[model samples]
Target: MLFLVLLGFPVFILCYMLAAPVFGYLGDRYNRKIILGAGIFFWSGVTLSSSFISELYYWIFFLSRGLVGIGTASYSTIAPTIIADLFEEGKRTTMLSVFYIFIPVGSGLGYVLAAGMAGLTGDWHWAFRVSYSLSPMGLSHSLWSFVWSSLGLTAMAFVTGALGMWVPLFLYRAQLAQGTVSPCLQETCNSSNSLIFGGITVGTGMLGVIAGAEAARRLRKINNKADPLICATSMFISALCLYVALMVILIAFGELFLSVNWAVVTDILLYVVTPRRQSTAIALQILVSHLLGDAGSPYLIGITKNDCSPQWSFRSMQYSFVVCAFVGVFGGAFFLLTSLYIEEDRKEAEQTSPSSLNTSSSSLKEAIFRV
Candidate 1:
């Protein structure tokens, strides 16, 4: 059981990194919401089907998990893009942080649920049984047939997947046809005047600023002096603290917390950046954060565990996390201040660079020449 649990990390890394971007491409070319919804719906089905497996069905179980991986890949890629579409820059980081709080909490709960189920039955079989039995009826279709039935079911699955692909295309055409501008596009227009625009230059940061500004605006409408700057600052700080707490939980009980943490973190990162750049942002974040921040922390801990003591390994990692806590807090603060800085920089550039400003103005006029 311990080996199975330990093995899942590498498996997750393999499947997640490889499969997620492919689904993301489908989402980008089609429709983000549809892709996300289908991904969720399909993964839920896969989770449900896992309940009935025995050793005889172990291969089937692996295949089902692979399918689930693909589905989530689509969702993880698109969800962040959707959030970016909906929110602004300065607030994007905070909002993403808040959204990510679920990763740790849900993972904690999943373990509790698994343990409770196993304890109640005294057999692991019931865990899968309950999962499959409780899952929606649609997923059971594959189980009802045998030998010859596999071909028909495979064909059916293909048709369903293709249909799922089309839903996004229809939604994209509808949104664009209706002249509903994406929130990111709207921000590019209003950003010149917004304080949040001064912070980060990336599309993700832009979405955060727009979202934060809208939230601040709503608050101000209710209270005369509701300074968005102060509100954003506070939220980002609080979120950073929450993230640190989660990291402590993960490092302290690495065995149990890792899988769910991966799922949750991917979801949060996806939500922070824009839809168009979801795959790139997620991939980049994975590559960079793992490379720079915590990538080697686990290996370092394992070496200590073997060389010194198990307790020592965990203890050493905890000290490292102390530093991470500071980084998280500082990172949030940095995002808020950066957005304001970028907005100011753009304004200064427009004021100082007459030729460049003129070129931009002329291009804008040409694009909107009719208006």
Candidate 2:
């Protein structure tokens, strides 16, 4: 149970990582203001409620933390994209830098908020309650794209979500099948799969991000649609590696390919969609990714395993994981399709983005004055 408490941070991260993409998809398709506002509202409510949890229900604390991550994900994925639309080239980069400055400011303010609240109220729970009361959160302005989503990245999300949660367990089940490990009904089973997998995830995540970014940077000098091409290529290779992930090294390679597109996909949406719609496109991409990917993949895999064969756990999971390979292929194919339309879309975006922003900015004022 203490270990579970220790896992709170990791749980928050995994939830944030998984939820960010889903929220990204949402940002692109829905009312940006509502989603952003709802996320902040949800975050504050959950955090405040969590403070009321009793000592006996520690798991709820973890659950609340995870929910908070999901709520924050909306802002994380949507805010910058909206900023991208609001500013022109000369000021865009500067605005983004300024926006990120809030990270440190918020972090620092949080410590003060918590400390001050706890000291004044004489209880940690009041810290959360007071902090929630003080938060001012919401957004105004709304607009609405599908081209940015070939659902390829969502496929990657599915693959990673399932693998991240289940690979170690799958390996342990494999060992059990091979009779290399004993399964005790009432005793804790021993295994190093989790630790080993964690190391690989950390190492390959860094390497993949760097490799993808560098490759895309070099390739874009010649190809305007380089982002999707790189994404497609990586997904294809990742699919192949994960299809044969029975080998330990193949898992590492699969993760490497999967990690390469984190930033690249957002880049694609930024250029493909018009400025007024960029926020919606980016947020929707995130929504679809999490909606189809990490948010459900584990359960999908687990249920398939159970339904396939109750008695043969290892074989069932083995077959279920194969779904990820096919999804990866589908994801790669989506990226390929994205490559076809990206150039045209980007051209359209460049031509209209400025005018679109100008029109949108005047819309609310015009309506108000007309009233």
**RMSD of each predicted structure:** 20.8, 9.8
The per-residue C-alpha lDDT of model 2 at residue 185 equals 22
User: What C-alpha lDDT do the candidate models reach, one value each?
Assistant: 0.41, 0.69
Span of 10 residues, lowest total lDDT, candidate 2: 138-147
Q: Please report the candidate that would top lDDT against the real structure.
A: 2
- Per-residue lDDT of model 1, residues 1-371, tens digit only: 33443333334444655776576556556777877777777877777766666656556666666666666566656666666567654455455545544433333334344545666776555655565454333011111111112222122222212211221222222233345645345322222212111121122223333444444445545642233233324334433543454344321211122111222233233322333445555544433333333323333323322244434443543443343334434433433443343333334433444445678899899989867
**Number of backbone clashes in candidate 1:** 28
The local lDDT score (0 to 100) that residue 132 gets in candidate 1 is: 48
Please name the candidate that would achieve the greatest TM-score relative to the true structure.
2
